[model samples]
Target chain A: MDIDTLSEKIVAGDRRALSRAITLIESSRADHRDQAAQLMERLKGAGRQAIRIGLSGTPGVGKSTFIESFGKMLTGQGLRVAVLAVDPSSARSGGSILGDKTRMEELSRDPNAFIRPSPSQSHLGGVARRTREAVAVCEAAGFDVVLIETVGVGQSETVVAEMSDLFILLIAPAGGDELQGVKRGIMEIADIILINKADGDLKPAATRTCSDYSGALRLLRKRPQDPQGFPKAMMVSALERDGLQKSWEEMTALTEWRKENGHFASRREAQARYWFEQEVRQGLLAKLDTPSAREAMQSFAAKVAEGGITPTVAAQELLQGLRD
Target chain B: MDIDTLSEKIVAGDRRALSRAITLIESSRADHRDQAAQLMERLKGAGRQAIRIGLSGTPGVGKSTFIESFGKMLTGQGLRVAVLAVDPSSARSGGSILGDKTRMEELSRDPNAFIRPSPSQSHLGGVARRTREAVAVCEAAGFDVVLIETVGVGQSETVVAEMSDLFILLIAPAGGDELQGVKRGIMEIADIILINKADGDLKPAATRTCSDYSGALRLLRKRPQDPQGFPKAMMVSALERDGLQKSWEEMTALTEWRKENGHFASRREAQARYWFEQEVRQGLLAKLDTPSAREAMQSFAAKVAEGGITPTVAAQELLQGLRD
Candidate 1:
């Protein structure tokens, strides 16, 4: 189908059309890239918006469980929910974190819910870019909520934060040293931290972990975008279906506050500009991937490794060659 | 002076010529850059090497005090020491972390020691590049040890780590939550963690912090370059000059083991290649700084922000323009 028909179908909340559009966005072929760009441009006229929540957690942090419960809750409340993931490791492992649709059986079967696994090709930057684009596609498809999930490791969290409206970090309850496992950079970007597994035997531990993180968050520099008592830690039990409603309420409250304070629109604008610069940087780096450029870089790298030429001098010569 | 004379003077331990060579390296002038490259090429034949130690800590962590005591100890042991700093904030504040020479009064007065402040202008990349070159000049000048210091925040630690053989992170003793302040990325790169200010009533707290960090480090994946009990934390009292000798011994022990295991030579080769790639990346980014390129980027960015064009499409157009 042409871009117009596909975009129209997507805006009408057709799941099959939305899936096809996302696949086009993930494809690296030249023709598909052109079509994807055209489709996105067409969809821009939809002017539909969703509450985009970025969620991240380490492996075994019960991310799938929480998403299943929370997504089901939204669908039951007459809201269409879409789930997308950005898995950096999928490029190497050929297995995505959300690859198993059975992991969220109930939500996957829900008519009002849409679930898509991560793309299992390309570098982290490309993966993130495609995921961000997929999010826009979901929003244009009349989804009331878009949940973008990523593993809590390396630079992935930062990339997810750039595309998200409110970033939530999920962590398993540990002993008194729970804060040690949290990265300082990740903590700085998180708008809310959820202590998962707050049911059964882990109840006391989760409460303690929640309080510890609350104190730690208090020590962080306050962001201008947040209202009072924001970016706080909360306890949640996805298994028991507890705290999901309260957490959703808090998310909507924060989103509404930001919308009233004018931070919501400005944040999206800044994120667009950030992604634009990132694309430019990636495009420039892609130039070095040609056979001749690779040969030149390898030869210069050998010289640098042997200490025969200073790194700066070798780089200058290589860049000069590119210019010529 | 000519490049030949400058290299010879630097090799022969002429401090003034060494200083002049570093100034040339730091200069942005075309002529000075050419001279600096030539001088570096000439000095490569000197074949002298020094232990390059990168130290980082937050401000008020007694970095100056620790360095003063450590430098005094090294100089007193008859080893010539050179101190260089990389301060990213200097570009904006016009003040450097190591700007005050009197901060290390005793070390500055020592005949066996050399102290230099951070370059007060340029971005972090340029500052790191010049500092790396200055390290080479110091090595040619027969310094037995070179200490590189940077603030313990942001990406500066990673930059300094790229140019140094050993990375040490210093922290002040805090009550039980010390690890919360440390960035996980920095912790992974650190070869050693030092708990400073272990004197007076804080001695007990320092020991507790050291133990806590030791447990945390043990949980991290073991690196192949390290031997048993490696990347461990230690307690030091820079105020009372306590643990200085023991820490020095540990550093030498680690260095000697790495040299024997062949990690020393390989690490430097890898660092040289890393720096070469960094320079190439920086050179590519510099193309975007031109007037016409700036205008193009702003126009594209504005379109992206206003939803007139997708970021990917705008970036592709901008890159195509560059190619044309």
Candidate 2:
């Protein structure tokens, strides 16, 4: 239970200890948090060796299948692979499918591969707190490659991008008009574009779709820093296992290039800084529940509704009320 | 400038007075807002007769063109139309394109049509405020139909649906995979699905896409609490004027049906209630900027970052600190 003992167990590659450590950190419990902090401090120098890659797509883009194929490929080459699949929690249940293990059964059964799925719980930050904590756990467990699979290319996926060394965006063969509707917010965040399900009768259409996307992508200005590559597009098929190796190779190449070029380290540092700021914002917002603050808010709102004043003015009045 | 005088002029079809009143309400200036409140009270019963329609799509869906064509159709039939197009504010400039009038030259020139583009400012609710106020202005100026075109159909579009009686979702003829990626959140909100750009070589593809969407849509359960005759789908072209009449007919049918069933009046009442609630939330959050709250927040955050506490615990500590 002590930090040093738990840290040793985790570093010795005990999966249970690693999982428990993540849970402790993720818990809102006071004592567990103290234990988690102590554990993270002891294991501070234990992580940071894994190649973290974030993969995202709209649902049904074969995200699970793609991870399975890519995991199998990595393990086949004698690389230790760990996957953290982040599923947004069901709004009704506040729980995830937690089906990544079943979806990646072969790799899950492999002694060299580990898979974990974390529920988002409606939090927009990419990778659940448990999942990010689990990545450090995985790294401490000596996994060389950590794959973070997130659902959709929205706020949740952007979280993955922040924590990842490489970010992959997956799409299908979309019609011209459909492609145009793709939000620039997501597109701007994407580092690599993969058009999945590019096999069978849809091959020609997929090819056309790829060309169309590639053409549109070209019109998008490059990242102010990158001179050569700006979200390179490729065609792949998770079912057919086609282009899986090629995509993996490209990912590895990008990681290596970024790491060597200083972008990787700097990117990780930036992510760490962002994580800190966001945590503070979330923390402060959660604190406005004091009795006087809450009381003043209620009275002010009642008055505003009674047509005594406007919202902006009422807000200022409430703040002054709090001060008194 | 008095409420009674302004109200009389607005009802007498004074366009400038209506525009100025809306601008005043949307203004943050304290005096302007007080005047706006007076204006709101006076005009409360004057602008409820217009048919409010919400149109949303991902960007590049030719939203402006569609609105222009739809406005033209209404004006051609001697019906007055007003459009409020919401444009995304560029983060860099903190300004919007506000180009709806430019894009809608034909409709703008028409005597019976009015077009206004509101900037999506720092506050999501602010954009919405301007929009609702603009709609009231149009209604007071005798426009029978008020069309609200959203900035885009991701998260922001949800606000538009809260104000409009009818919600129309525009999508392109998507192939199989992209179809799966469309958020079910969007589908659930859509009262009518309009497949835009169904023309030329895309005609057959569009028809096939329509069938696919129709089939997929059938799998969804009937929306609870929604009136019957919701979720109609049709193909349309803003450029070619294809299916424009059918789309308009559906809107009219829904409006008439809702009016007959008493849902129309209730919907407007619900919208006003919802707007007040949203304003309260924004107003209360603004109170969190008080110096005492800010200081307590910083100190608690330091504790969280130092690993002596968790965010939730830190939150409680801040609230407790406020009491001191």
Candidate 3:
């Protein structure tokens, strides 16, 4: 595959090319990583600023239903929508993974919408890395809206937050109050909270959940650049497609506000630096993952377990051996 | 200043020498670190498996009061108690830093109890590292119980959990239901839970909280080696010291069960390797923190921000530069 040709095709809004590019980036082959980098460089600034949205909730939170309706709503507005799900589960989620595709049958069939479930890889980091590169590829493919969906597990939630302009947390009505769903980790990161399944008898519960979440958000500190201050939350019934339009509007408005306030740019810049440092650590460790270093580390670990050497000292020795 | 002499003194239960050894270990100077490592080597296998109890809760959960009363009770039973606090606050904690001395007035006066407030430090890792070493010193000084208390913010709780034989989570009655505190991180690590302030008018609420926690713990899977098969919870009033004896008894029983089942040795061995890997990462990052590398990394970060380089590639390049 010629890197320049692939970049050009992706830039020209070819869905097949975008899919191929994502596949290339996700490849573990060294040559592929090199070509992927080249393709990224070539496609730099080729697309408009995308409305990057991060969606997350626990299993059974009606995430698929919400995304199907939400994606269809956006596509109806004549906007190109790209959905990338970062699936981290190796068990029990097989059903949900397939269920999502069947549930979103209409949206998946839409010409203006592109929906891709995560590949069956057990590594969460691999999924996150691919999802990030895929987000960029979708942008280059001229998708105006990129919705990255991840389960509300710790690792994926963190990855989604780092790569998103807006994070929307979806919750079911009876998950023991909105406060129960809201923990310190995701609570601090979420910009918009949506209490899903808010129709019929559950409407009152949803309203109370929204109010509870709103009250909780008030007590926490907000990002310095957010002019609207506290995170805004409301209830929605994705089954009825009610409140989907308002949620979309709120997301876009919040995004515009963040962009205007320079947070969007600053956050992106900071994320770039953050990933750079992380990769440096990972890249260095990759050297130690070699057979010789592994043996040395094992021996050093044995010595550490025997109590003759401290971990700090053993690590220093291993690093020295690596350096030498 | 000889490390051999210092180690001998600490092993002999010399409080002044133990305090001095801890101060030496906390020092950032290279020579002190070397000496501290030597001291640890000398004190290896000196203490007979001290009971390391990690205690944590949110700020207003009566941590100090609980520790004070609990330490007093243990000392009253002739068990030497050493309290090592990891204080995050810069404010009124200054008074508690002393207030602990005055507030635990009886315990402070007890020859069998040693209470030390945290040394003023901005870096959480530094504090954690020092606290870990301090626990060792306390153990060598013939303290059978080392209670490491940290506030419920993320990092400290994790550090305390890693170094502890058993983790005890202290919570007030009204801090939401039991499900509220049972998030992924520290919650999963805790072996025991105490609903503090469980006396008089608040007794019912504490009992409810305990039952709620017990129900929640049952819903979660336990470690295969946990003979009890679930984390136990109970109500206690620090003022009345009602459950202190039972809490200590539970901790000893759990520790003994884990030791017999091989979880204790395995966990310690695992922690040694965990810290070994972490130290390697930290030691390598320390190399980058140098002036020359910092300047080079800054230029690379600039290029990353300009989108000319991907963070993965930039990090790879940085690691290569360090190697070269």
Candidate 4:
């Protein structure tokens, strides 16, 4: 199908068209890139927006369970929900985190819900870029909420946070030592810290962990976008379906406050500008991806390692060669 | 003043020539850059080596005090020392952290010690690049050790760590809350953690803080380059000049082990390649610094912020315009 038809179908809330558009965006083929660009351009006129909540947690932190419960709650309230995962490690692990729909079986079967796994064969930057585009496609398809999930490791959280309006970090119940395991950078970006598995024997532990993180978050530098007493921690039990409503309320309250304070629109504008600059930087780096350029870089790297030339001088020579 | 003469003078340990070479490297002028490149190329033949140690700590963490005592000890042992500071905030703060040599007055007056403050007018990347080149000049000038100090805030620590053989993190004596204040990313890169002020009333507190960090360090993932029990935390009192020798001993032992195990050369090679790639990336980005390019970026950013175009589409349009 052409760009116009695909975009029209997407705007009409056709699930298959949205999926196809996402697949096109994830494609590395030259022609597919052109089509994806045109499709995105066509969808721009839709001007649909969604509550983008970026969620991240370590493996076994109950992300799938939490998303299923939380997403179901949104759908039950007569809202359309879309889930997109950004798993950079899937390229090396041979298994995407959300590749198995059974992990969120109930939500998968819900008519109001759509779930998409990560593209399993791209670098982190490419995956993030594609996921951001997929989010746009979802919004154009009239989704009320777009949940972006990423593994809470390395730089992926920062990348996910950039495309998201609100970033939620999920963690298991543990002591202060476990708190040390959390990346400081991730903590700085998170708007909320949710202690999952707050049911049965884990309730007290989860509560304590929640309070610990609340204290930790208080110590972090305050962001201008957040109102007073924000970036707080809450306890949730995905299995028991407890605290989901409260968490949702907190999210909505934060969203409403941001919207009222002008932060909502300004935050989106900043995110858009950030992505634009990122794309430009990536495009510039792409210039060095050719076979000859690779060969030249390899040769120069060897000389630099051998101490035959200073790194700056070697880079200047290579850049000069490129110019010539 | 010529490249050949400057290189000769630097190699002979002429302090004025070394200072002049660093000034040239730090210069943003087109002609100065060319001359700096030639001078660097000439100095590559000097083949001298220095122990490049990068140290960082928050303000009031006794960095100046520690460096003064440490530099004096090194000079007393008949080793020439060069100290370079990288302070990205100096541009806006109107005062470089090390601009006041009185902070290290004794070291400043010591004939065997050389101290240079931050450039005070460049971005982090430019400051880092210049400081790195200055390190090379110091090495060529027969300095036995080059110490790079950066304020332990923001991204400067990572930049300094990239150019150093070992990274040391300095902190004040405090409890677990203070531990939380340390950036996790900086902790991951640190080779040693020193809890300063281990004298007088703070002795016990300093010792406890050291043990706390020691436990924390154990929980971090083991690095392949480190031997067992490495990346440890220790207590130091810069005022009393205690623990300085032990810290130096550990640094030398780590450096020796790395050299014997081949990590030393490999790390430097990796650093050289890193710098070369950074220079290439920065050179590519410099293309957008033109007035017309800036205006174009502004217009596209406005469109992206306005929701009139997708960020990816706007970036593509701008990139296409560049190509045309």
Candidate 3 lDDT at B300 equals 95
lDDT of 2 by residue, B1-324 (tens): 787887788888777777667767667776886676566555656634788888887777778788888889889998988887665453225655644578898998987887766754666667776677677667766788888887563456778888788989887776765564566667777888888889987777778777777766676788643566567678998889889999999888877887887777667756665565565455545544579877766666565554445443455455555556
- Cα RMSD (Å) between model 2 and the true structure? 7.1
Clashes of 2: 1
- How well is each residue in A199-285 modelled by candidate 3, as lDDT tens digits? 999998888888788887787786785666448778999999999999887887887887888888888888787777767766655
When only the first chain is scored, the TM-scores of the models are 0.97, 0.88, 0.91, 0.96
Q: Give the candidates in order of lDDT, highest first.
A: 1, 4, 3, 2
Q: How would you encode candidate 1's per-residue C-alpha lDDT over B115-216 as one tens digit per residue?
A: 888886667888988899999999999999999999865788998999899999999999875576687788899999999999999989998999999988
Q: Which stretches of candidate 4 lie over 4 Å from their true place?
A: none
Which docking band does candidate 2 fall into?
Answer: incorrect
**Collision pairs in model 4:** none
In model 2, the clashing pairs are A126-A159
Error of 1 at A197 (Å): 2.7
lDDT for each residue of candidate 3 in B257-309, tens digit (9 for 90 to 100): 88988988888877777777777766766767778888988999999887778
List the lowest-lDDT window of 10 residues for candidate 1 chain B: B92-101
Q: Indicate which candidate wins on lDDT.
A: 1
Preferred candidate (lDDT higher): 2 or 4:
4
Docking class of 1: medium
Error of 1 at B127 (Å): 0.9
Alpha-carbon RMSD to native, per candidate: 2.0, 7.1, 3.6, 1.7
Candidate 1, A1-324: lDDT as tens digits: 999999999999888999999999999998998999888888888999999999999989899999999999999999999999988888888888663589999999999999999988768888888899999999999999999998866788888899999999999999886687788788888988999999999999999999999999999999999999998899999999999999999999999999999999999999999999999999898868779989999999999999999998999999999889
